[model samples]
Target: MIGGASAYDGTNCKAPGNCWEPKPGYPDKVAGSKYDPKHDPKEINKQSESIKAMEARNAQRVANFKKTGTFVYDVSKIPAAN
Candidate 1:
């Protein structure tokens, strides 16, 4: 007979014919799927590009502020934090 609680992540299949085993404290249905970077390479590249662009913009803003001794800002305009 199959015995013991299964791993919560369901990445492990303990023994043979024990597929119906239950995991304690975590329901089997809500576990996230295993990560596969190969499945979404374009999305990953887009995110990477966006991060690089933001870093470059921030560095430029900091350099400009240091040189001019004044930071540009408008109280009425604020970028929403996504």
Candidate 2:
């Protein structure tokens, strides 16, 4: 790599690391993270929706990286905190 920069993982994130690692308790059905069918319905449902959204976003980032070698950020895409 030029300037000795390490290979960028999907979204310019450092490769060979757990940058893609999900939160401990998250059950990502798409990313194949731990999934407990017996998990509480309320918690699972809530987590599932948010997890799915995040997975979609990250997948897009990875795809963009594959196409352009980096993720192009647009701050307007993010929702502001309350």
User: lDDT per model, in order?
Assistant: 0.60, 0.61
Provide the global lDDT of candidate 2 against the true structure.
0.61
lDDT per residue (tens digit) for residues 39-60 in model 2: 6678869978999988877776
Give Cα distance to truth, residue 16, candidate 1, Å.
Answer: 17
Encode model 1's per-residue lDDT on 13-73: one tens digit a residue. 5766566654566455554534323456787699889999878777666666676677745
Model 2 quality (TM-score)? 0.36
Q: After best superposition, candidate 1 residue 30: deviation in angstroms? A: 15
TM per candidate: 0.43, 0.36
Candidate 2: segments with Cα more than 4 A from true spot: 1-44, 73-82
Q: In candidate 2, residue 20 scores what lDDT?
A: 65
The clash count of every prediction, one per candidate, is 0, 0
Model 1, residue 37: C-alpha shift (Å)? 9.0
